[model samples]
Target: MNKLPPDPAPATRLDRSQRSGPTIRDVARAAGVSIGTVSKALNNAGTLKQETRERVAEAARALGFRPNDLAQALHRGQSFTVGLISNDSFGRFTMPILEGLESVLHDERIAVFMCNATDDPEREREHLEQLMGKRVDGLVFTARRADRRPSVGVNLGDLPTVFVFSQSDDPRSFCLLPDDEGGAYLGARHLVATGGRRIAHVTGPERFEAVRLRRDGYRRALAEAGLDWRDDFFLPGEWSEQWGRQAVDILFSSTAAAPDSILAGNDQIARGILDALRDRGLNVPGQVGVVGFDNWGVMVEAARPRLTSIDMNLSTLGQEAGRRILRMIGGEHFSGVERLPCTLMVRESCGAQAKTLFQEARST
Candidate 1:
């Protein structure tokens, strides 16, 4: 009897895969529809009645059905994936950009392959090659600085490439950047409207293109307000808190009429200016109004008097870049540089009653 029971146990040839879990067929059966209709409803492809789509979705949920992404990619002949390569080591910029970009991508069930080049040319080249080999639908390159950098070193014709917060000399490239020049103009104008005369510009090195552009903006604002753009009033130094403090010391120690206000290069420097002013018994917004660029929340919020600064709208930029790349993937042609305008995040440090002043300035 035991020998007969053992003989009866010979296994069926059907593999375990066919025996386990819910598949599209299971959903179709549960929803009382064809497998093709289930697929169409789930993938949002081809028109279908709203009730039918809802029924299929309910069936999938109840059965715990998950369509295999690999199978779908194969059927569609597209990986539904993209590559994002960046050299921003200090995640201050890249993290938010990814957050914004991925929000758009997740809706379409697309995936991202992120690569950090670490500011090495060889490493960047290898990443580019690897992404291309993976047959990605599109590529995005980003960096901390707004300066021009070398292209990916390979001619990728019509591959839906996008560059953000950085640029290339290639005339045909689609580039996205912040309008730093206009931002600086806005900051300086705010100081003027706040009643700052003999204003000093304390900023980063002149070698940076951003610094130069901001300088032009400062000059233009001063010119418009009929204030003198004096050479000594322009203080160029490293973009650091220490430099901000040092510039303040140098300005106060001088025999020339001390600046009634200062426009710092970045948030860090602005915080330092505030700290130095505290040490020297100077009042902000009353004795000296202060404004900064790069309304970085970490520094601005933590500062003694929260900083009033320029907002680069980086998240908006990232979202727009994602939308543009999606359109590019759909065969849209875009070329040349696109500069997005920056906004002023008015706060306590600007020496005016924050609410009414911000409203008034925005109205103009």
Candidate 2:
């Protein structure tokens, strides 16, 4: 074997300074703070005065010094990153939450790692272990609905965690859920305010916790307006536009008087109801008012009179979750369930002109 041409002279290398960035020590000097303080400020751990942390951050930004020593940071049990695990494969709900969460964490220089568990137990367990191995700073769990589900099987051992669109069984666990009952109430009450009596609720399966809550809310709104809820007026079917179209015929045939207003469980059903009503030569908001949940823009915009719907405020929920989780990571404890209020997207479907209606004054 021709002796490897005397191990070809080693290729020339660039000096650390030539390809390097400002060091931690440089940041410390620029901020007039100790290296420990700089690490605390950048790594987001340990005790440091707020003003001093801000100074260190500003100096690091000015010098373009970013701490990239992962091993050293994890050895101290700190990582300036979070892990978000979601079961929503469609991203129909999770995307908005992620957008809000990133907006909050990005400002603090904390990064997030997203994982899709897709309603699989084994996959979720595996993701939990992997996130732990990465030494994430905290965890956020989001589901597609506000139903009670199994707790995280893995023992996170004091790791910060927040749940969204679902409630944990444990009272000590921090949970967030959209106020579905309140949302339905707002929809029905708006119908009443806009002169809709004989209101009928066409909704999804009753097995769903949200469905039952909305049913109760619909009844409550009518009751408050001195209108009794007729058992025949309530229709429960699968969550689909087809069922919505079918229900219209069923209601008209069974009841002596047709419902003047219909509150659909979701935008899909609302669109179907609108289509069927139009076919029957009924003028929306004149012959019948309509409302839907979820405020899904695609279906709402397509429906005649622009389907008035309840907004779950998923983005706001995500932002709030991010803020609270960060606080938990910083030694604050937030336990118990927090039900964020839903918003009403006022539109022509409810006999109201499409207009901006802020939530706080909803009753008006």
The TM-scores, one per candidate, come to 0.81, 0.81
lDDT of 2 by residue, 103-188 (tens): 99899888889999999999999999998988888898998777888887899888999998877776778988888888999999
Q: Estimate, for each residue in 1-364, the C-alpha lDDT of model 1 and write its tens digit.
A: 3454445666778777876689899999999999999988988887999999999999999999988766676667677898888999987777777777787777777788899999998899899888877778888888988888877787676788888888887888998888888888888998898898888999999998889988988888899899998998899999899999998998899898999988888888888899999899998877888999887989988887888888888787788788888898887989898888888888888887764543211212
For model 2, where is the 10-residue window of minimal lDDT?
355-364
**Model 1: which residue pairs collide?**
none
RMSD of every candidate to native, in Å, equals 7.0, 6.2
Query: What is the TM-score (0 to 1) of candidate 1?
Result: 0.81
Q: Local error of candidate 1 at 303, Å?
A: 0.6
Instruction: Name the regions of candidate 2 deviating beyond 4 angstroms.
Output: 1-69, 360-364
Look at candidate 2 and tell me the lDDT of residue 197.
89
Q: How accurate is candidate 1 locally (lDDT)?
A: 0.85
Worst 10 residues of 1 by lDDT: 355-364
